[model samples]
Target: MLTPTTASPRLKLATAPLMLLIGGFVSLQSLINGELASRLGTGLRASVAAAVSSFGSGLVLLTLFVLLHPGSRRQVATLGRRLREGTLPPWMVIGGLAGGLFVASQGITTPTLGVALFIVCVVAGQSVMALVVDHRGWGPSGQTAVSAPRLFGAVLAVAAAVLVGLQAGLDPAGAGLGLLLALLPLVAGAGTSVQQGLNGRVAAQVGPWATTWNNFVVGTTGLLVFWLVTFALPGQLTAPPRDWWLYTGGLFGIAFIALSTVMVRIHGVLVLGLWAVAGQVIAAVVIDLVVAPEQLGVLSFVAAGLTLVGVVGAMTLRARGVR
Candidate 1:
């Protein structure tokens, strides 16, 4: 039987920090994957290659775990039975396809739109969709009415992302092409809320490990198909470099997804997304400070601060509403 989505206070306290940490992992994964993509090849095809590598490597790792761990194997079997019985919706398993789209969009749009604009568009889509997903009870946590604070948090989260990249300035070189490409990440980001909700539903039935494995399976297959379609495109697939760190993106993704699968069932998608934004902002700031101190700006710190403020405000306000 599935566990209830309502979490105890203790669980809330424990999970919040974990969600933030998982968000940091997400930031790290993006860094690693972007580096990998830049190094492995060029053009959109190379982006697909990096994405495929991330998903495929994660799939292999999860596959090994399923083979070795009896508990995970049983959970997978149980989920299969539930699906066969029609107790679980089959559509939920396809959440990973959204993940595939999200990564692919990063490759397709970032060069044209610039990371600043892309992040803003993506965060905007994610924040808005998260509100709808939570309010409509699409996730395992059930319906959470959209309160003023929650709404504010969503807006603030987007603002924080925008603030972080304020100094970077959006590129206007390919305005027409960038606008079209921008839609890809916008839609893809919205899909992530759906992905989180679906993963939570699946995790409620089986477990996070099994749910994460299932995501990797679907995501890997989708990315593989994407790669094949782009195979004949005009781009060169450079041989994999010997740098070991480039290959760790998938491992980071595995951790992030598994942790998020568990956390989303407790906090709902909006709050979870806010917390994640906070973590990502903080981690990015830290990375900048360490890797290139000269480029770091005061606005980056301010953006990180605003993300935390948004998260805390939302949490406090939502808790009162529940009471």
Candidate 2:
């Protein structure tokens, strides 16, 4: 088996494009899941169904792939042995719960918030927490100090979120509820940093695919129970839609999660967050323009530019600092 690369401060330029691609997958997943929710049920029931469908489908797919791969099977056994020996902390494997929270939040709020607004809110939360994750050495790449460039980059990312939020122009009558639902994605966004950190740790031991499978296992199980309690008990459930596109959220999610599992170790939490957020902002902006051109504004485009600047500045400045 190939040994995992050690987390290093040196920038790996080759990985930048892949990180951006993964970020685009995130926004795409939200759009797909939100559409699924709209077609499936109402209120929280729709959210639960969307979340369960995405995670459950991904879990099934990953389970089959892992079971079929001999190397992955050995890795799973090794992970179990490490757990028994107390070499790997049990808490490290629970990162999927964080991913599940983000997914559930997307399902609940994305239809109402729209992809661009929802993604910016997530970027707001993620950019802040990623700084904390890196500074505290919680991520797999180890401690990355809160340097001026890093801090400024985070501020820029958050500022971009604020710009998008201002442009969103929520309805006056529904502003209160809108604000409340927006907060859910904000909190869920923060959890993504934690999720990436933990998953990166696990991925370093096994492979990205195996780590992703484990995430699906834990996330799908948790979402299933949440759906049972909240939607199933209240009799809010509805039959899932037959549309093939509605189910593509899981495939997009798997791509992003697996890619992120690898990228987090290379870029560290904060830089990775910025890069992903940059890509997410661009994708979200394009999507909003296509889907709801009436809502597009100068500020939205400006926010996207700022996000790109922030990501580039963060990576370049950090690399310079390291050198």
Candidate 3:
């Protein structure tokens, strides 16, 4: 029942607050994807639908904006031209696959692990990878050394995950499977970290709007193909309940992707990961409480607070330009 609408989306226009708000979207996205996964746990309907909604809605809005702003259209043209001339790395174009991986993994993991734990593990992965990625100068932000403070921050993030796992009281019977499923988001996080860097580079070439549009094109194509393949399996496609909130994932997806495209360029991957994780953990706690208050407890709150502390610690180091 959720089809792409014609209305343009209201984007976060300011560059400064984009990073902060994107955090909110990060948690929101996870919750939405988790619900979508639950609805289609028997099959792939939820993942596919979520992906399509994300890409289709974002593309439609982007197209409208580009048409109205000649400057934006020109930027898209420039990116195309540059790609044709081999000025940009061809790999940059595939950055959207990261989004595909994210939604797909959520479909598999979130229902089991819950959003708070899922996000904590994701932060662990992002913290480690972003440290390496930023340290190696793989992204446009240049090299940031993995100093003591940065290393400590990564340790804290890992600790946060451990705390959540402990609080969940992982059942020994299902521990293996639960841990395995939970780890899937770590893979998603790696994809996202790389995707952030690639999109950042592309943003330099075509501007943020076009960079996000390109991500939608590639990511949506991939998801749509997978969605079609799901029909071949034995499961039935389950439509989500008529709750309007279930359908808002795509909008949040667009917002965060666009925000990350810009944030990676400005703050680098590590900073973005830390800050975004802070947002995700905090938002996730509140969302979980609202969704199923009985499922959460004080330990969840502790995990969230720990994540913020780690993020703030890393941010302080970055602010000081610590070598």
Candidate 4:
């Protein structure tokens, strides 16, 4: 009863810009997460709690939207049938767990490392994992063999990540531990990337709205379950600050996830991932320069330049089909 979906040219064209926008949302999240972590200071646990709260709020809003919108109701029913028939892959479900972990890691690490450093670390993880996933063609979209150009791009991305890391002012003693924690989200991000690819394929078979809602439904459920078990202790899962700005961040987070899901359907993971990283780098630089001027040293600029060059270079190579 399930059929594959295909993106029209217009949709494909839209993916690039949309991915870039999603990257901006991600950058905002970095700033917001760092601020929250600094205030809470419970380390990784606090980040986990924040992730739970943010996602939990998004889930509630999405549920309300589904109830209010007559069209969404139909989409949900259709998706339910797909779920019943086992049309969606199990691995895609696992993507939800990865998403939750990524959020928690961001909340914990961003304050210590700063947005620039945190993003680079996660991007390093994402680039390498994305290469492996693409090369193996292991996910829902089938294998899109890694060409030579793609491999080169991955190398460049890694180099960029390294440059950014070196400039991040990380303590040598804590670097190992920090890097390990950072990888949790990176791994989770890669899973989500793959999940997006698979979901894209399934979305084409179903409808985009259905695919988006299904992911939200599944991912939200996963987040809530993990949240309840992990942070049910006293004083955990408390509300964020009373400021409207904090809640604004939550709204942006919801929009970011929703839009990125749509982007994955059009651009494929490679483009989506690359553009998202690029946007984050730009945003982090701006934030650093404005919010924490001391962090924007000469090395930061150099590293940022190197990262931009690498991203551009990789993109050029991809365009030319060198990989």
Candidate 5:
């Protein structure tokens, strides 16, 4: 639902800003997912529950879409055939995997780091890996040759992670573990770029909501399998969440997936990612101020500024279009 509702007149503005606004929802989703995890008692169970909720909501939306625009259904009717015949890249569904992991990570990390620092780490990870993903052709944006600007971007992101991680470790016994946990999003966040690319490709063929439906199926299934195998371990599966807000993570997820599909297509991943970075940072800062203002300080802003600098540096050359 990246598209604006008829009743909502404020968001009918130009495309770029709208996309950035949508990007900020990813931060909100992290906050909600974290809450859901805290209620559920473990990241693993929380992730599975959230994925199921996301998939359930997605299924309902897709059903409505199919009912309203029966024509689009015809377009995707060949989705199965095409997937089997190799007409579509099998990896387009990677968005689901990326999403599942992201929610899981958010659940695992957000409480400890708070929304602002947690999102900063996610952005830091995404900024660094996006370069490699672009260069290696793992991303939907196609091959982007490695360059000085991109390298500088990566360095800045790493430095920003360290800056943020230092604060994250301040009260903990194992600062090293804190540092590692802060940077874990670096690896997890890279999947998002890949997911955007693949999901964008799917949107090109089947349409935006349809693409999300596909992602829901894949991501939910992947997490379900993981949950079945791992939930038996200690400190894994616990009680179900009681709060209504916890369930809203799926709705937030649906919004962002659709936004990424559109924005990544319109603006290349560089601009889209960076623009969304601004949105997430702004939202994260606001959320922290309202809820846990004490967690963020000078170091948080410095890390965020460094991440922004990295994003700008990466855009110095080519952060857009096919190479």
Candidate 6:
């Protein structure tokens, strides 16, 4: 009974909300990863061990999906050809190494730093690098100039991260060092996000399913290699906890990879990344207040509120084409 025009609009209306919902889900899943890392840090396992195991699980899951899904094989082959043709940059593989480092850092430091501080540090690093990445358009998609709105959003996100750090009671000297180390993963994540955005832009040409599978495959392989070289040596890595909850971090990673691809399609990578950071900050605040009241103070809330306002304003400007 529905005409094509009406159906298309209706579909868009339905899909926009769904995309936002998925974004929220991705954020919550990230928070869960933070929690899992904190818990697992108490165990003997190296953070790299958890990261490797999670990536291994994700590789298996994606491989299974590709095998069972009829059209995925063709898509994978086509994507491989595209990569060979140089449509996908070789540097993306480095992004996977970054991912491994991030997981390891989270596992090693999250307990000492707490979720709120960790998220803030990570977001700060990500936003600063994201600005550079987005401005340069260093991914599969051709370059899109960075706009003012995007810059404003990045600043706000950084401010929010700073506020979170201040709440962590870190001495100036120690905070400086922690912030520096945190930037490593943040820069890596920004690269990953750019790649994701580029992938979304080309999704219609190169099947999304195929692209997703290829990323996981490459990322997993890279992480596996890292594990072998750095942590898999005897006495270097600890065994992972046998409990099911420890595995939640890996499950969250799988969900994030898939949902983030969908989000990049609906929201520009910059906006999606900002919102994701916002969500994590919100969760981090709640976690800190409940678990570590010493980290909660007046300045933290004020900075958080200001950062939120800035993010919202930036998003509004973006919607108005003022970016």
| Number of backbone-clashing residue pairs for each candidate, in the order shown | 0, 0, 0, 8, 1, 0
By TM-score, the candidates rank as 2, 3, 5, 1, 4, 6
lDDT of each residue in 236-317, candidate 2, tens digit only: 5568788998898888987887777567667655566667878898898788778766655677677767777877887788
- Residue 128 displacement (Å), model 2: 0.8
lDDT of 6: 0.60
Q: Which residues of candidate 4, in runs, are more than 4 Å off?
A: 1-18, 163-173, 228-239, 261-269, 296-302, 321-323
lDDT of 2 at 259: 77
Per-residue lDDT tens digits for candidate 3, residues 142-240, read 776677666777788778777766655556887777667767777787777777777767876688888877887788888888888877875665655
Candidate-wise lDDT, in order: 0.74, 0.79, 0.72, 0.65, 0.71, 0.60
lDDT of 6 by residue, 1-323 (tens): 33323445455456555444443443443444445554444432445555666666767787898999889888887767776998755554344455555666665555555555565566656666666665677554556677777678668767866665565445665876555544544554455555554555455556777766665666667666665665435334334456776566556666766766655555545666667666766676676677676755675676556556766787788779895
TM-score of each: 0.81, 0.87, 0.83, 0.81, 0.82, 0.77
Top-TM-score structure, candidate number: 2
Kindly report which residue pairs in candidate 2 clash with one another: none
Tens digit of per-residue lDDT, candidate 4, span 1-323: 21113667766665567777787787787677667655553544566666766566666777787889888788778766776789854554444555666666667766655666666666666767767776676555677777665566567656756665555436688777655655554565666556655666666566655666666556667766765665555334344576656545556667886777656656665666677778877887787778877756665666666666667777787778675
TM-score of 1: 0.81
Top of the candidates by lDDT: 2
Candidate 5 accuracy as TM-score: 0.82
Lowest-lDDT window of 10 residues in candidate 1? Answer: 111-120
Clashes of 4: 8
What TM-score, to 2 decimals, does candidate 6 have? 0.77
* Residue lDDT tens for model 1, 187-243: 887998888788878988988888888888898899988788887788878889899
Worst 10 residues of 4 by lDDT: 1-10
Q: How accurate is candidate 1 locally (lDDT)?
A: 0.74
Q: Give the Å shift of residue 14 in candidate 6.
A: 5.9
